[model samples]
Target chain A: MRLSIENLYHTYGKGLAFETAALKDVSFTIEEGEFVSFIGSTGCGKSTLAQHLNGLLKPDSGRVLVDGKDINEKTPEAMALRHRIGLVFQYPEYQLFEETVLKDVMFGPKNLGCSEEDALRRSRGALSLVSIDPDIFGQRSPFELSGGQKRRVAIAGVLAMEPELLILDEPTAGLDPQGHDEILDMVLALRKNPKLSIVMISHNMADVVELSDKILLLSHGELLKLGTPQEVFGDAELMARSGILPPPAASFVRRLAEKNSFFSSLSPALTTEAAAEEIAKALQGKFE
Target chain B: MENIIEVKNITFSYPESEEDAPAEPTLKDLSLDIRNGEFVAIVGPNGSGKSTLAKCLNALLLPEEGKVCVAGMDTSDEDLIWKIRSQVGMVFQNPDNQLVSSVVEDDVAFGPENLGVDPAEIRRRVDEALKAVNMYDNRRKGPHQLSGGQKQRVAIAGVLAMQSSCMIFDEPTAMLDPSGRAEIIDVICDLHRQGKTIVLITHFMEEAAKADRIVVLKDGQLAMEGTPLEVFAREDRLREMKLVLPFAIELADQLKARGIELPKDIVTEEDLMAALESLTAGRKTAGEAVPCA
Candidate 1:
């Protein structure tokens, strides 16, 4: 699904004493099958923006267009928009409340009025996509699964909805290093589905640098910058001012450039290999 | 200088259910000793029994076998449980789950109050603890009014109010954002500097790297234990246990692969920067042409 967000404005506790504008004039677009990452400090309305994707929160002003159709409209088409977008919350595994993994995953599809057989088929497909062996995990309660497995089961529940757009809010927040990679690999694998687009809200800048096709940077309810990883993370001063750190490689290069005039010709790099090339040049005094 | 918590051959298991065969025991014959005023980090993959080990520290769970001694008091002794608990405060992953009172100071005061400390002493401790965590200004605010970082700090403040000599944090930053995670880590580090023994159970490798010592667990057993550099040096073992090397370490390895002569001791970001700085300084003097990638 192609999502076009325009001039989004939202406020919490509107007309109350403690009213705060959580999002202000935020605008961005996410094309079909693109992996878009939203990053900012905590309480920067990343969660608020994710809710708007599925029409969970209607913007106080502005529009969220899903495939050129405004999702906030009061119509049957708008109502179905909820099913078109699946949202996986932070620590989503806590929401699992089913007797078995299969039952838990089937909940969403079943809630959408799919037949039991169809829901079971979809649940099985989703389980396999997340690399969970249905034979081993399908019969067990989600509570019995380990932390990483429980999270995957929770994600499978959403994937069973067959969303054209999947919005995840810090899906790897509490996971261990191994669990973090597992979830990330699963998300990366999901990108192979041409029909699915992903919108992720994350705080891990390294993950953003590695995975995002495009990045939307938010700072205090304002859209500070929107660009690819290289463009967003390339500007050391901007990233620093916004309270975001680029990948270590970028910072290393930036510091080296500052320390020696010879290294000034080297461009900023986001990945380890790219930075290594630059570092090797400085070591050999091969400044272009 | 002295051992504050001593776990001796502890083993624990949860009850089985009918859905499948009995699950493996959560913790195996695990033994560890946390020294006073030391910052110790326990890191492992999920189901590695890190959380189970944290629970045993303050008698939250009595080990099915063996013993846990806190500040010379045995955890299994029913009469001494309170004393052990009072000396070893605990902070959990979710700040919201641990907080009870609406007001910040009131919530912090709850711990001291429960211990039946006099109101005057409780008030003083509450103020002191809040000050320590830099939440004194928000003491009058409702718990809901604070940000996630602030709330977690308030949780730390609550623990401080109990006047515990040691603190056990169980994945305290798991639910927080990056900044919130840093806030709690800073608070704990500050507390450790103040001579309070800290046992931090975390999954983040960077956090673990900051600790004076890191303990690695694998499938409920103590797989490795040493300083951060010592434990993390075993890349093969860590990978086998499903742990990721810290980013700096990974970068250093990548650089070393490309024939960069960095010190093997480089682990933290600062270390990587210093090593690179010194290497490039040598290049400036020698004026040698390096190969470009």
Candidate 2:
């Protein structure tokens, strides 16, 4: 489904003595099946923007359009639209409350009034999608699992709802490298669904380079930059101003340019593989 | 090098594991000495007992069969545990888990007060600690209002207020973002520069690259221990342990495998460029910035 947010403004403690404008005139769009990423410094309305996409929070001014439908709290269809968009929060394990993993995963589908047999089936399918063994872990309590495992289960619980637009807020935070590997793999594998759209927020530039198709930069609640990760990292001065560190590949290329005036300009590099390839070819030209 | 902390044939088992698990021990005859002012990092996969080793350093977890000495003080002595902890303050993974007071300054003061420091002395330490972590401006702010990175800075400040000679961080940046991790690392490096011994435990290989020495823990044993270059050069061993090498090292290794003339010592982006520029010197003309290792 297409999601368009236009001139959105949200303030906490409105009319109170301590009002804070978290988001101001924020405008962005995510087409169906597109992978969009929102990046900004801390408390710059990244999370606030994501919350408006699904009905978790309403905008004080402006509108959130889900397939041209306004998703305001006043709308009769707002509750149903909540099911269409699934959000796996920053730390989702905090929301889990069930005796068994199956029960936890079934929470979404069951809430949507699916029958027991169908809820069980959806829960099992979601469990398998996250690579968790259903038979082995279905009956087990979530508290007994490791922090990473619990997070996956929490994500699967959201997946059980079959959301068309999947929003993940720092899905790999606080995980070990291996756990990070597993989490990203799960996120990438979900692309096989074909109909699903993914919107993820990440502070790690490396991960963002790997995942995002469109990178939206939010600086102090403003739409600073919206383009490919390559475009964003290419501007060294702006990146430095925003306090966003370039991915190591970009940094390496920039460093090389500084020393060798012959190599005055280079395309943006993301992964280590790309950097090595581009640098090697550039060096060959330099020597030959 | 003079040893500040010595580990001698240590062995330990957590109390609540499976009874029939054969008592495999968390630390198996592990022995090492941390030089007085060295910056060391311990890295291993989950459940590898790197944290267990950290706890043992400050007497939080005593070794069942061996001894851990911090500046010549034995860990097993009950009366000396508090003194040892003061000498080697620790910062844990979760900042929220350790901070006790509501305000930033109050939280920092908690550590000095615990040692029964003089009121005026505690006030001095509190200011010094906040300044050390760069959290002096937010001293009056409530702990809950600060961001995750700021909270971690407060935690570092808390540990600093105790006047510890050495600091140990048990994956202190695990819960923080890239910026937060950078901030905490900067604090650790500053402390190291100021002549305080630092031992940091982390899963991020890139972070480990910044350390002077690296100790790899596996199943509660010392699998590998050496400088960053020495340990990272052994890609096969690190991979087998489910540990990833730094991106720079991986890129260098990839080029080396492809028959390019990159050196084994190329562990950083700067080093990689240096090696490349030397080979491509003829094409590089005036004003072309050439890299140097």
Best candidate according to lDDT: 1
For B1-293, candidate 2 gives per-residue lDDT tens digits of 68889999999987764433446777788887899999999999877889899999999999988899988999999989888999999999888888898899999999888789999999999999999999999999998789888998898898888888889999998888778888989999999999999999999888899889999999888999999999998989999988998878888876766557876787666677778677657665423545443
Task: State the lDDT at B14 in candidate 1.
Answer: 83
Clashes per model (N, Cα, C within 3 A): 1, 7
DockQ-based class of model 1: acceptable
Each candidate's interface RMSD: 5.2, 6.2
How high is the lDDT of residue B74 in model 2? 98
Give stretches of model 2 more than 4 Å off: B17-25, B276-293
Taking the tens digit of each residue's C-alpha lDDT, what string does model 1 give over A147-248?
A: 888999999999999999999899888788878888989988998887889989988877888779999988899998989998899877778878876776
Q: What is the overall TM-score of model 1 with all chains considered together? A: 0.94
Q: Write the per-residue lDDT of candidate 2 for residues A1-288, one digit (tens) a residue.
A: 888998999998999977889888988889888898889888888888899899799888999888888877576587777679998899898888999999999999999999999999999999999989999999988877877889999999999999999999999877877778888889889967768999998887888998888899888888888889888888888798787877877777777777865455555577788877766666554344
Q: In terms of TM-score, how similar is model 2 to the real structure? A: 0.94
| Chain A TM-scores in order | 0.96, 0.95
Single out the weakest 10-residue window by summed lDDT for candidate 2 chain B: B284-293
